[model samples]
Target chain A: MGELLPLMLQGAWVTLQITFWASLLAIACAVLGALGRLSPFAPLRWFSITYIEVFRGTSLLVQLFWLYFVLPMPPFHVELSAFSVAVLGLGLHIGAYGAEVMRGAIRSVAPGQYEASLALNMTPLTRFRRIILPQALLAAIPPGTNLLIELLKNTSLVSLITLSDLAFRARQLDQATFMTLEIFGLTLVLYFLMAQAINLAMRLVERRLGRGRIKGGLA
Target chain B: MSMQQRFDDSPMVRPSRRDGSAEPLVRFDQVTKRYGSLTVLDQLNLEVSPGEKVAIIGPSGSGKSTLLRALMTLETIDDGVIEVDGEPLTHMPTAGGHLIPANARHQRRIRGRIGMVFQSFNLFPHMNALQNVIEAPVQVLGMSKAEASQRGEELLAMVGLEDKLGHYPAQLSGGQQQRVAIARALAMRPKVMLFDEVTSALDPELCGEVLNVIRQLGEAHNLTMLMVTHQMGFAREFADRVCFFYKGRIHEQGTPEELFGNPREERTQAFLSAVNEAH
Candidate 1:
């Protein structure tokens, strides 16, 4: 049982690494998608909204399976590892969710901000870079931080496809050693620790961004 | 930073005007503005020379604000052209001297010379007083931060807002915010400045300070000013000329003495009497 603890810990580390890489991909996709949807041009808006709706409408499991099985085996072919497939699939799915959250945050920026930027004769690009992005990021952090935590938990579901995350190791250790209680209990503790740490860090970030607006911030 | 271009040739807003060439600094030629079916401005014609301070007064919905907004290009003209310094506002000519109307980029280039201070003082809430003043000069006018900061300091000093530069808009009182807004507008070094009821949103006691700042700016800066105000006494004191609008058109316009003391139009007479009757 104790031996299984070290293996589970190793798997937990790998799981966290995947979550971090996937979140980086997801946030990049989020910034691009939100900008597309919010663009003044109709074509970009239509393309972004369509991409989000289609991805969000499908099941995440189906997306993972497709990314793993279908995308690599086409007559015009490319190949990737199971871990990469899982991360890309999860990121793609949540990137859609993150885009919507970003859109909502951007919409909440007061109309005066837009008018004020226009009054200054600001170019559209400069306006977004300076005024719109700063305010939108401040508004986006609270809900977005929670979404990232949910993304970490959902990474466990990828262990079903043999990416060897914590949940996969837990099942294997329970089967080999018949010490299900201690091994599975340790896995649960690891997830709790990881998720709580992420939550706490994000709360700190939210406080800094939302300063002066909220009283007793982070509480 | 360099005042060379605007001041080099006799410093006239219209070179022809002060030079006796008679070019109008701003002209609204038979302009009409409509929102859906409601005509806010109808076939309005007006002219102001370089450095003229014109105050427009009427009850709400008389389209005075809309008129100023149209000049700033914040609101598009439905029917006519706005000319600034002998140039048509929405377009310019190529080197060949062929007249081509402007695209968004060109419009932005020309609109650079116009500044507006809103009644609500729409300072960016996330920005502190200093950033709000410096943003346009740094971004739109392409000044470096150090240069922008120096210019911003001068403007804040002009508005008596040097002490409040570190505070955010939400922290400042209404009058202070409006003064900061005036500084922001001035930082652009715009030839034309538009004020849409600048004092209407301030407290009665605070209104005097902001108005005084504006009066000084009007006198000191060679700016073409278009203002919409309801403060009769301030209008009488500050305006080089007064335009009394009724419904959607100017009922009468003249110097303050001619407009206030010897208004020839019946509508102007009634408006002046009602306003002065307010104790």
Candidate 2:
């Protein structure tokens, strides 16, 4: 039990870092992807669609391996750090999916809002910033919170990249002490706790945004 | 003959230059707008002096709302020009008199002067009633936060929503929401205000409150309000002038008494009678 505490605590630190960086990347990707899909240009729309489909179509493990091995090989003299590449792969793989989520959220803003803005002669940028984005982003949070929790689980794959994340540390402790079940079981508990916290945070946000009573119905 | 104007034949539209007043506040000159072959406003011309509240009543698809939308620069007319407060919209060309490439900046400048309320009360769902009213003044007018809040509070009070400042659109009743929408438009302190069937979506039970607010606006404010509504009673009671639109043309227009009580056009009489019967 004495040895178990340090191993788990150390492993948890790596897990925290991984989750932090991954969430940041996911949000950045979601914004870019959302904008790309919303772009008037056909190419941008097609490219965004393609990126989302390809990433969501394949397995995340395969993509991670491809980034770590295949990308670094073949006449490339640079030896980029595995940790950086792993986060990039994870962010890219998850961001494509995140972007689609964003697109749907943005599009859900009613036509009435657009007409209202037009009447005021609001510039499109101001219209989005003041009127559209805040509402869409608020509406998007409940669904996006679930996807983000899913992202935390997939980030376990980053352990294979030689980073000392929770999963990686678990594997090390299992081999050294010949106690695989306990180590792996503890890893699962940590992930479960982390995911639960995320869910809780999301619920709080949902409640805050949902407090408003919509002024609807025709006179 | 080449254009359709609300005031093409009307004595009111011919605000004479001899008076030495400011140039016409709004003008739609020989403007032809088409939605991919469906001609909405064909060579439409209309004008409003600095202080005129023109209530436009029309049959469906008669382009009443489109006229107001075009002035707000929400919908662009394909040909000819629209001017707001004497500034040529669609931009001035290199040689002048020709239309340049339409840019959002130009649209914003023109639109800033025009406030519009839509058929649907399009309040920002995320923002509370107070924030919605405070948006333009703080964001577009660049009023200091204190000034914007002060003006916003006064506007909300005017709409009878001072108690409901913290309430979101989803939280308010329809009439209350529409009142907030009106207050939101007025928060801009615009040169012109457009109401496009604002009460069309309301229940009859709930409409009177909003109508009463509008009547107050017309009676008290020194405003140039262009409203497209089917509320003929309100049109007659509140409007200084009323214009009847049909097949993309103003078929008849005059003082409310002349247009509604003693409608000169046979078609208008039939339409108003039918509307009166339906009610």
Q: C-alpha displacement of B104 in model 2, angstroms?
A: 2.2
Candidate 2 root-mean-square deviation in Å = 5.1
Model 1 segments more than 4 A misplaced: A1-5, A211-219, B1-22, B93-101, B276-279
Interface RMSD of structure candidate 1 (Å): 4.9
- Model 2 agreement with the true structure over A1-219: per-residue lDDT tens digits: 469769877877777776768778987888788988899999999888888888889988888877777777877644667777667777887788888888898898887888887766566788887778776777688778878888887877887777787778888888888777888888898889989988888888777765574324331
Candidate 1 docking classification? acceptable
Best DockQ goes to which candidate? 2
**Model 2 CA lDDT for position A59:** 89
Q: Which 10 residues in a row give candidate 1 chain B its minimum summed lDDT? A: B9-18
True contacts kept of 1: 0.38
Cα deviation of B90, candidate 2, in Å: 2.6
* lDDT of model 2 at position B183: 94
